[model samples]
Target: MSTDTNAIGLHTSTATQLAEHLNILLANYQTFYMNARGYHWNVKGNQFFELHVKFEETYTDLLTKVDEIAERILTLGHEPMHAYSDYARVATIKEDTHVSDGTTCVKGLLAGYKSLIELQREILSVASDADDEGTASLVGDYIREQEKTVWMLSAYLG
Candidate 1:
């Protein structure tokens, strides 16, 4: 290993930086996941059943992402932020206020996904620079997956 590199072959400072970005992502995902769950249970409209199922599927996926992100943080030799207060503090995505309306919930989900994809893109660039293939690959996949979801959800709204 190089003098500056960590056990995983990534530069130690870059690993720490990536961990910070991942922690921010983890917090946002946690809050967004909860908002999706709320949307799942409370959504109402002619499209109620379809949206409810969609929100459930969304939250379930977000929950899994949350776990994966935290694990990635640990892999970088850092601790994941666990408290709701910390999540609220660092997350750029706000809690969903228009919960019960299908249109509003979908809008909120899209906005949240936009924030996530933006952050993940930043991390992907940093990870690529550091030669941290694990982090790069993780965020790269998420960006691809979310970009598709964004297009599909926008079509749903139209």
Candidate 2:
């Protein structure tokens, strides 16, 4: 195993850990994006237009973020896992099935947002330990976005 000092340079253990964490984050984001898309397509009842539009915006933001996080992993000298199968395996956020209502969808998405926040916190700790200030900053940005999404989704439930 490479020492922390050596890893601090180019090909470090930190990079590898970050790469794995990034893959997990990518998968979570992809799942969230698809779930949001599903909600956008199937939302019904009173607040349909509002919920649909909001879900679309959330998914679109996630779509961009997924790409950015993957690219960042590649920039760190690691290959970003791109296969859907791989994402399904790595993601902590489970796939949604049989979502029947807007409220249910919102609840699921709120859970996902919370999951993402937890994942980002772990990644942030890893980045901080590795002295990867850039990754830490990126994780912070993601945390803010996820928290805001969760708050908005939860508000709809109240």
Would you estimate the TM-scores of all the predictions?
0.96, 0.91
Off by over 4 Å in 2: 1-11
Please give the TM-score that candidate 1 achieves against the real structure. Answer: 0.96
What lDDT is reached at residue 93 by model 1?
A: 88
Worst 10 residues of 1 by lDDT: 93-102
Q: Whole-model Cα lDDT per candidate?
A: 0.93, 0.85
Which residue runs of candidate 1 sit more than 4 Å off their true CA positions? none
Per lDDT, the best of the predicted structures is 1
Give the per-residue lDDT digits (tens) of candidate 2, residues 70-146. Answer: 98898787888888999898888988976748889889889988998999999999999878887899999989877
The collision pairs in model 2 are 7-12
What overall lDDT, based on C-alpha atoms, would model 1 receive against the true structure? 0.93
